[model samples]
Target chain A: MVKAVINGIPIEVEEGVTILDAARKAQINIPTLCKHPDLTSSASCGICVVKLKKNNRMFRACCTPIEEGMEIITHDPEIIEIRRTVVELILSNHPNDCLKCGRNNNCELQKLVADFGIREEHFDKFVRDIPKDSSTGTIVLEASKCIKCGRCVDVCQNMQDVWALSFLERGIHTRISPAGDIKLADSPCVRCGQCSEHCPTGAIFEFDETSKVWEGLMDPEKYCVVQIAPAVRVSIGESFGFQPGVNLTKKTYALLRRLGFKAVFDTSFGADVTIMEEASEFVERFVHKKGTLPLITTCCPAWVDFMEKFHPDMIDHFSSCKSPHEIMGVLSKTYFAREKKIDPEKVFMVSIMPCTAKKYEITRTDEMFASGYQDIDVVLTTRELARMVKQAGLDFAQLPEEEPDHVLGDYTGGGVIFGATGGVMEAALRTAYYLVTEKQFPKVEFENVRGLKGVKETSIKIDDTKVNIAIAHGLSNVEYVLNKIREAKKNNQPMPYHFIEVMACPGGCVGGGGQPYGVTDAIRTLRSKGLYAHDDAMKLRCSHDNPFVQKLYNEFLGKPLGKRSHELLHTDYKARPVYRK
Target chain B: METSVVPDIANVVEKWKDKKGNLIMILHEIQNQYGYVPREISFQLSKLLDVPLARIYEVLTFYNYFKLKPPGKYTVSVCMGTACYLKGAPELLEELHHILGIKEGETTKDGMFQLEIVRCLGCCGLAPVVKIGNKIYGGLKRSDIVNLLSQYSKEGAPVAQPV
Candidate 1:
């Protein structure tokens, strides 16, 4: 342990702990812009500098390790002045139109400027004239607002292993862009939006589509309906001043009704249906040997895009089931519209998702149009939903708890847990075990396939049959899993596992690229715990036990993977070139 | 979009295939052979190295030396060193720009001459020097640029050696 005195508060921390962390332990606030809890510190911003008494040298607290007996003055008059100057310099290059920015009041740099009492620009304003790139249609690249923090680049290249973004030039000329100065849509971007999630400013953000939803809502002819994803229920509370893990599922349904939606549904219901289709598919493949082993889940659109581009060879292994929201969209248009005697063309379906990639997934293939119209008309991120709620002048916290529309809103514990990493595997296994052994498993909860680990491996036995399963989240962690499979295939070795799940974001949808900002592991765990807690409190914990899903299957779709289910619930994949021609 | 690799570039890739820091080394070889890196070659290299095209472009763009396009047949380098700048080199550069119809580091429309601003050519004594191809012209006036460039523009013109 290393002992340090931060602002006269003596604290002891681990040897390799940064001074910033040490000061944090001592309750000394050292402001940082470039350093995020989820990313390694690049120390690009000078705001976290602290004064050392022993050597009398100012060091960047974020990157410097705390030494024994080191007297660190994290906040002195001189240090404040220096930090204030740094903020001013950053402001000089940044556009002062904060109100027009998407980040606006939530920007870290803006927060620092306000905290430092910066009233005016001290230096001449010299903002770059880079035009925004919205080619991907999922995230926008407003390069002019970037402060060269390197967080987005780090997340994109190192964390995600999607080298679609990089520091193209050097020094003042340096800007984050795709390799070859190509449009992001043409680049190997997977539309994951992690870059936007990691960005400290509005330089990277989800392409706002709230106005489009408003247009649909205001149109008297359009029957606008909205559905909330499983992750959004736990995550959207952060924007309304609630803790990260607070479940606001009921409140959100009430809030959406207040916003003038004709009907509100739950994507968890769609997740339950997905499990019905996916679990049966697994049984058909694993039991009957009809398809390839190690059926990789394709619920996360980002993971699907990544597979289509990087690991196209594994296309055969990917499950043909559509994502939960997409399933909800198609069903809402076809079944809901037909049952209610409403025109399918007038049914404008919007999905409130914790993912930016869902925006792209809505129109990914012809299967998305299986309802004879665009299944999902609009997709709003959890952050965007928060904005829409605020715009509607509704106090989300004070909203009365309510239930979703009964026809397609009810969900099971298996459905709700789909928000977290290894959740889909657990959910699938619950139903797959039943499908295989013709009996409900003794324990519904699979403890092994849980948590924020990048790669999770476990095996479950159904009677005498042992089923090997592997779950991986975050795109970078996927390479290791793929390589192992590749090596086995090359050497004619036995297949590693019977099932695999991949979510592009680290902690699944809870840590999605479009969730509330300032997300760390603590926040992700809390948000995931919220879903798990919701699961535990539920009476029906398995997907097959979801009565509404069973009702849908009985009333409309004959059975899982039947002609009707195949038409609406399942989709296909094709190999795609990473870059545009 | 051309997936077919040139034999020369393939040879270059094979030569540096086993070595570390081979990307830059192979890029240097390609640049030397073709005078500048081509888009097609970069695509081929990206496929050969199993590296992302963005990574190769990042490295190519970061360094001032690498060029992404083919250079002109002749390069007209105006020395912009302190000595040359003090000796009316800017006017000489302007004259060349006017005559060639191209900016610094850009080739002419006809692909005949490329204009560039260079630093000290180790001939400070001969300030306001202009180097065209291998030959250096010292003590030059703004008016002399048009005449000097005309000598290289004509088809099958005999180029003078360095003096």
Candidate 2:
């Protein structure tokens, strides 16, 4: 351990810990803008400048490691002046359209300026006249609002390994853009929105489709119906003054009804149906030797798009199941419409997801139009729903807890855990074991495959045979797992694993690109805990045990992987060009 | 939109394949050959080098040395450094535009000449300098631009020395 004195307070920290972290241990708040808990500090923003006691040399607290017996002064009059000048320079170039920005109240830079008590502009305003790029239709890039902090570039290049965004120039002329001044849609971007999620300012943000949803809600002829993803329930509470990861599923159902939805459904129920088809498909591939080994999960749309572009050779390994929300969408227009006697054409199916990629997934393939109409009419992120609740002037905290509709609302504990990494693997295993053994596994919880680990590998015993499984989250971590499969194929060796699960965003959908802003590893843990607690509280813990799913198969659709299920619940994928041009 | 890789460009890309941080050097070579980095070459280089086209473009556009469009037969550059600007460089540029029927950073319809504005060509001793290809004319007036164009038109080709 290294001992350091921060602001006259003595503290002991592990060796190589940054002074910012040491000050945090001493309970001193060192302000920062470019530093995020999820990324390595680039020290681009000089807001966290500090002084060493012996030589009085100035250093950035974020990147400077604490030395043994070193004395550091985090804040003083001189330090405050330097930090203020840094912020003033950044503000001079930043746009003054905060009130009209998409990240109006939730912006990091705006909060920092307010904290520093900056009342007036100290420098002459010289904002750039760069035009906005809304080519992706899922995320918008307002280049003028960028502070040139390089956080978004780090997340895109280093974290996500997408390299779709980069600094176009050096010094003051530097602006964030896709390579070659091309539109983002024409670049190699998968529309994950991780760049937007990591941006400290309003420069990058999810495309606002709330106004279109509002128009559909106000139309008298349109029967507006909405479904909520499992991840949305845990994270939406952050916008309502509740702690992060507080489960508001029932209250959200009541709120959606108040917001004028004809019926509210749970995406977890669609997840249960997905498990039924996916687990059966796994059995066919693993036990029956029907198709490719190591069947990869196809729940996350961003992962699907990434696979289609970067790893097209692995297309044979991808499961044919549509994502849960798309399944819910097609079902809403078909089974729900037939059951409720509503016209499929008039049903405006809206999906509240913790994903921006869902907006792109709605028109991704022709199977998305399986119900003879557009499956999902509109897709809104968890942040957008929070905005609508505020716009409606509804008191979300005071609303009594209610239930979702009967047929499509009921879900199992296995379905609820789909929001976290390795969740789909655990849920699928619970049913895959039953299909192989024809009996309950007794212990349904697979503790081996749960957590925030980048890649998790485990094995389960079914009867006398051992089933190998692997799960990976975050797109960068996927390369290692895929390389193993490619190596095996090259050597003509036995398959490494029977099943694989991949989620594009880190920590799965709970830490998705369209979740609430200011997410960290701690926040991901809390959100994962919320889903697990909800899962543990439920009576049915397995997907095959959900009675409503069975009823849907018996009454409306046939069995799992049957003719009707194939027509509506399954889809195909093809290789796509990296650039759209 | 035509992204088929040419054999010569492919050879150039292959030469730089093993070198670290060779994007700028390779782009310089492309610019030297074609007078500018064409869109098709940029796309093909992205595929051949396995680098994101965005990253390549970021390097290509960030420096003022790289161009994206084809240059004309005779390239004209007006130095707009502090010394040249104070000596009425804008008037000279306006007159050149009038004679060539093209704006800065553009080629004439006849493909005879292209106009550009640059910072210091290291000849500040001769303030208000204009360079056509390898020949440099220093201390020029607005009226001199017409005479300069007439000399080139009469020769029907670029002269090795300034008139």
Candidate 3:
């Protein structure tokens, strides 16, 4: 432990702890722009500069490690003035269009500017006239608004391993763009939006489609129905005054109803259906030897895009099931509409997702049109849904709790846990074990496959056979698991694992790109805990235990992987060109 | 798409394959060989070198040395340094553009002349200098641009004199 004096207060901290963290432990907040908890400190932004007590040499608090018997002054009149000047210099190059910006009040730069009370610009204004890149159709990149913090670059290249966004040029001429000045849609972006999530300013953000959703809702000829994803219920409340991870599923349903949706469904129900097909497919492959071993989950669209672009050879190993929301979209227009005596054409299905890639996933393949029309007409991020709630003048916090329509709204504990990193694997194991052994395990929680670990590996015994499993969340962590599998295949060794689950974003959908902003490890844990808590409180804890799911299989689809189920729920994957000519 | 260029680019990439931070050096070689880094070459390099196309372009566009388009046979560069700027270099550039019918960084449609602006040529003593090929024309006026450009024109292929 190293003893440090911060702001005249002495404290003890671990050796190698940054002064910023040590000061944070002492309850002092050092302002930072480029330092995100999920990324290593580049110290590109000098906003977190602090003074050493003896010689008073300036040091960046983020990158500097605490030493024994070091006295540091984090804040003073001179430091505040210097910090304010730094912000002013940044603002000089930044556009004064915050009100028109997508992040608006939610932007971290805007918050810091407000906190520092920067009312007047002291530096000469010289904003770059760079045009916006909206070609991706998932996230927009406004180069002129970029502060050159390098957070997005770190997230895209180092964290997500997408390598889409790169810093072009040096000095003031530097700007973020695809590696070769090509359009982002033409680059190997994969539309993950992790860059946008890590961005501090309005430089990168989700492509706004809320107005289109509003138009669909206002159309009299259209019966607009909506479904909320599992992760969304736990994280959406962050936009409001509610604490992070507070379950807002009931309130969300009520708000969607008040937002003029004809019906509100839960994606957890779709997740339940996904497990039904996925677990049966796993059993058919593992027990019956019908297909390849180590069936990978395809619920996260960003992961699917990554797989198609980078690992097309693994297509045979992917489960042929549509994502939870896509399943909900098809069922909303087909099963729910036919049962309710409504026209599927007029049924506009909108999915409120915790992902930006979900916007891209709606029309990815022909299976999305299984209901004879575009199953999901509009996809809104959790941020977009929050904006709609605010626009509708509904007090989300005080909205009376309400239930979704009975048919597609019912879900199980296994379905609700599909939002976290190891969720899909855990949920699939619960039902896969049951299908394999014809017996229910008393302990349902797979503790080994939980938490925000980059890569999690475990083995579960189903009757007599040991089922080895590996779960990787962040895209960067996926390469290790994939290389191991490749090594095993090269030597013709026994399969490294029987099942693998991957989510593109860190901590799965709980830390998804399009969720409410300001996500960190603490927030991811809290949001995941909220999902597990909801699962624990549920009566039915398995997908097969959900009575409505069983009814859907019995009445409409004959079996889990029957002809009708395959037509309505399954999809195929193909290798895609990384760059479009 | 061009199969002939693949082996050449692969050889260039092979030279820098073992080195760290070799993207800029590789791009410099590609630009030197082709006079500009073509999009197709960049795409091929991305595949051969196992680097993202975006990262390659990031390096290509960063330094002003790399160009994405071909240059003209006889390049005309007008110094726009501070000394030249005060001595009507901007007017000289405008007059040259009018005569050549090509903007800065662009080649003529017939592929004879290209116009460009340079920060400095270290010739402040000869303010407002214009260089075409190997010859330097210093202390040029706005009117001198047309005659200087016409000398290189196909119709008049007269032997030009350095000012």
On the 0 to 100 scale, the lDDT of residue A40 in model 3 is 94
Candidate 2 per-residue lDDT, tens place, B1-163, comes to 7655353887888888899988898998999888889888888888888877777878887898898778887889999999999998999999998888899878988777889898998898887999887788898999888878777778877664663
> What is the TM-score of candidate 1?
0.95
| Tens digit of per-residue lDDT, candidate 2, span A79-193 | 9989888888899999868899999999989998888888899799888898899988899999999998888898888788788889987788888988766788988788888
Per-residue lDDT of candidate 1, residues B99-136 (tens digit): 78889878988888888889999999888899987778
Please identify model 3 stretches exceeding 4 Å from their true place.
B1-7, B94-112, B122-125, B153-159
Over A5-82, each residue of candidate 3 has an lDDT whose tens digit, in order, gives 998999999989999999988999999998999889999879999999899899999999999989999999999988
Per-residue alpha-carbon lDDT of candidate 1 for residues A1-581, written as tens digits (9 for 90 to 100): 88778888889999999998888888778899999998889999898988987676999999999888999888878889999999999998898789999899899998998898988776998888888999999999999899999999889888888889988877777888987667899989999899889899999999999999999999999998999999999989899899999999999999999999989999999999999999999999999999998899999999999999999999999999999999999999988998899999999999999999999999999999999999999999999999999999999899999999967899999999999999999999999999988899999989999998899999999778899999999899999998889999999999989999999999999999999999899999999999999999999999999988888989999999999999888899999988884
lDDT of 3 by residue, B78-141 (tens): 9999999999999998887787777898898988887889989988999899998768889999
TM-score per model over all chains: 0.95, 0.96, 0.97
**lDDT scores of the candidates, listed in order:** 0.91, 0.91, 0.90
Better of 2 and 3 by TM-score: 3
User: How much of the real interface does each model capture, measured as fnat?
Assistant: 0.89, 0.93, 0.89
